[model samples]
Target: MKFLVLGATGATGGLFVEQATAAGHEVVVFVRNPAKLTPRDRLAVVAGDVRDARALAEAMHGTDAVVSTLGLGKAKDPANLIADSTRALVEAAEEGGTKRLVIMSAFGVGESLPKGSAILRFLYKGGRATFADKAAGEQILTASPLDWTLVYPVLLTGKPSTENVRAIDLAELDRLPGLPRISRADVAAFLLATAVEGSWSRRTAVLTTGR
Candidate 1:
């Protein structure tokens, strides 16, 4: 499969690119900085901004699927960059005639999870503005004609994958008492698998480690 990644330079996005290429898929990275990506035969880098629909469409052309791991830094303003970028991506994908889209969003952005501790809820409340942006992004995808799967991952860690990840429904997720953290590598792996195998299509799944 031919794939286009929107946040190729990001930590999770980079892993997705590597895994996709390793899986023998043609990977095209739409990124602002091309130097950050390692040289790979199956990887192609395209320079562009997520806000520019034309550029995104150009990069998305001839692609079978798109994976967006776009995010805003903590230091950034509350302009909701991810939501804006997702709107642009949806428009670009629509124009480019690409149907499959897999986007990553943090858990507890829109729906309340059950296992969140006081600290987690407090932190999430503090960053409510950012999560609102993510919610808007998810709304855009859900409303679009494209076949989209939104994966809400819990707190991300740098540890390697344990292959013990499980997908929880919204109600089950909300019933939990504490948030579960998953490795970024595992998130990437799941995104790649979903893109190729079409698992969890048109559904929003909360992903986390069993432990």
Candidate 2:
């Protein structure tokens, strides 16, 4: 499978690229600065802004699946960047005939907040802007006909892959216990599995290190 990863420059995104390539899948990373990623086998870099639909469409040509790990890291400003990039991906995917799409979202975005655990709701209280931005982006993807899987991972950590990650749907949250978090490596593994196995089609799942 050929994957076009949108946030290859980020922590989780970089992990995904490495994992995907290690698994023998071809990977393409769209980034503003290609030099940030050292060239690796089975990896191709496409340089461009995420909001450019025409450029994204060109990159999406022959892409088997598109994965977005894009996020604003500590730039407290409220820019609807997620929404803007999502719009471009949706348009580019439509134009390029790419069907499978996987997106990284947080636990409190959209209905995840209301349907989430108490701890999740409280933790995201001060992240109104960020959550809203992610929700807006998710709204666009949800409305599309593509095979999309929205992954809502609770607070991410830098730990190595637990290899015990659980992908739980919203209704099954009650089955999970305590304050949940997942390692970026685990998230990357799940994202790659979800795309490759064609699982969780058109559904939103909450990812966590089940206790």
Local distance difference test, candidate 1: 0.85
Among all candidates shown, the one with the greatest lDDT: 2
Best by TM-score: 2
Total clashing residue pairs per candidate?
A: 5, 0
The TM-score values for the models, in the order shown, are: 0.94, 0.95
Q: Which lDDT tens digits does candidate 2 get at residues 1-211?
A: 9999998999999999999999999998999999899999999999999999999999988889999899998877658899999999999999999999999988878776777667767777889999888888889998999899999888899998889987888755653445778899999999999999899999988988864
RMSD of 2: 1.5
lDDT of each: 0.85, 0.89
Q: Kindly report which residue stretches of model 2 are placed more than 4 angstroms away from their true locations once superposed.
A: 171-177
Q: For candidate 1, list the clashing residue pairs, or say none.
A: 114-174, 114-176, 115-176, 115-177, 115-178
The deviation in Å at residue 107 for candidate 2 is 0.6
